[model samples]
Target: MAASGAVEPGAAAATAAPSPAPAQAPAPEHLFRPISAEDEEQQPTEIESLCMNCYRNGTTRLLLTKVPFFREIIVSSFSCEHCGWNNTEIHSAGRIQDQGVRYALTVRTQEDMNREVVKTDSATTSIPELDFEIPAFTQKGALTTVEGLISRAISGLEQDQPTRRANEEAVAERIDEFIVRLKELKRVASPFTLIIDDPSGNSFVENPHAPQKDHALVITHYNRTVQQEEMLGLQAEAPEEKPEEEDLRNEVLQFNTNCPECNAPAQTNMKLVQIPHFKEVIIMATNCDCCGHRTNEVKSGGAVEPLGTRITFHITHPSDLTRDVLKVTKNPFTLGDSSNPGQMEKLREFSQKLDQILEGNVKAHFIMNDPAGNSYLQNVYAPEDDPEMKVEHYKRTFDQNEELGLNDMKTEGYETGLAPQR
Candidate 1:
């Protein structure tokens, strides 16, 4: 054995194994790249990886970007040189929404087909005209156009066709006829309805008319079913101990309730949440496992406000397409008999004015009349000042108070005040 403090120089080299090369620290990875408040342009990073198709060297490019007026997403594309196969997928970097969203768009124009669509892996796509549906979890998430979605589905159906033709002639013939019909939709021969239902609420369909109602597009947000919660892995494990009182606002409180649809008993999950600069509101969501019915409703949690609130906002360009605002649709004006030339001229003038607003050539005012004062138009510069928004509080009228059932409400001396009415 070598001496404790002294070793033969040649012996040490021969006895000891070669030191392993210093391992390099891996490049720090993040699901999404940090971006600043201003608009940003993100570039893709390319890496060499093994191809899943041919087991050969392939190139994978990753792009972490934020969609305009939307959330951040990671887009990955892989291409194999040997097999000439390629694939792409999009994953949202944002948190799961509290509710699900369904988008139905009537595709009537080429521009409609060119609209950008974000479909999550857990989203289902359907065409009502064709009675065709691509179920959730069957395809990866995508960031593509309406036409691209249909084209991809067509390609997927055709992939196994050659084998089917050799083995099952009858099946091939039926599919061929279906393929021709799908091709007709691609050509925009007639109007079709495209529906995307996403339980995660992470999917999106671009709205050409923002800050205004789109007649051809109808979007509804609803509570997810119990099964959807499990499928999305959002079923929170019950706490071992009871939730503390201090955290009641943050805790999800479940209460026994009856389903409004089938009258079956179920549970309604509720939480006290405060919207920014808005009053605390209770968001109650109910799901009935018996009838598979789901419902979401928001209730103002405090006493009626003393005064009503009205917000008048100047609508500039409709870029905030993702904002969820209630747009009440009503007829602009009643049309008179077409035989009257005077009424026809008035209608034509009104139509041109509407066209100007929709074309972004003229600005419009969007007003919100909230009697409860809790409802509000979202302020981008909350806690600060926004030049475009004007908020005013006014005393409710007698009719308004009657409608709210506040005619007999008394802030002071309610006990004596009610005796007179009795």
Candidate 2:
């Protein structure tokens, strides 16, 4: 072959592929460089990029891996095939020198937008100490003024008779109206307090235009305590007790009387009798001693008498509805013409209306005005058909007796002319 024509050097060798050279070792500079202070300082000390929702930066692109009841974080810096996003892994090797320094990315079960976990710096690091104390509210004494007096009076009046004879609905409406008016008055007299005396049951508004008087005097006069003393004298006077004979005369009958009919022995016998033009009936019980027969009949004579036919009229000043009925025998009054039948009819109508209103079946309000510009509103209710009134009367009588220092027999009985026969 060498003699064949001065063989072209390396021509056949070039036509054949050269054998692969032994793998060359990588240069030392190509490997990772050791961490240095300058590298640590130059490294991103602050987060440069963050997951928009969670606000954490650990990777260039986060791969969302869903797990059962939880989310998974894949830390490899690989492009996500599903999302087509490139990722870069964060290395703390240059920045953190201590082995204790750790970097972790947590994937919470809850979505970043839905939940937030706040990590607060310690109080010693950030929060300042504070001293807290409750503030005190001081109350001043009530104002002394005519307006104050008026407000107090109105409040006391309403408080003393909170319930009206009107039906519940009507009463509620009236209460609302009254409250509105009270609020207006309160606004007009700011910073003043109104005190009500429900127990005294006497209330009146002082007229600012009128001459100012001492509050104590006004209260005493309004309550009629002073007037009462002057007219009725001091309440210390001893009350007179009924004599013993009156008690014997008024004693209730216990035994059954002899029967006028068939004298047979009877245990239960009672009859009711009606009276003409009266609201009350009478009952009587009788019995026969000889034949053991008993009978009872209501007697017309035993019926309750009608209330006094004579109606008196008097101009009343503003006063509390709960006050005791004043004895106005000496007070000035204008007599209505008793002879005028028409006037009497009107009076009857008025009384009927009042009665209906009091019975809670009708709604009405009474506003009485005196010539002196004083006014009063009275809310009355029909008397309950209860025996408790009688009991109360007896108790009052007993109290009066004790106050008078009367003996039991004298206090319990007095001659009242055969018990007035009813």
**How do the predictions measure up, each by TM-score?**
0.55, 0.14
Question: Lowest summed-lDDT stretch of 10 residues in model 1?
Answer: 1-10
Candidate 1 per-residue lDDT, tens place, 274-344, comes to 88777888899999887688889888968888899999988787652224443222222122221224434
- lDDT against the true structure, per candidate, is 0.71, 0.28
Q: What are the runs in model 2 whose C-alpha is more than 4 Å off?
A: 1-185, 188-235, 239-242, 245-422
Off by over 4 Å in 1: 1-41, 237-299, 302-366, 369-422
The TM-score that candidate 1 achieves is 0.55
lDDT of 1 at 244: 69
User: What lDDT is reached at residue 191 by model 1?
Assistant: 95
lDDT value for model 2: 0.28
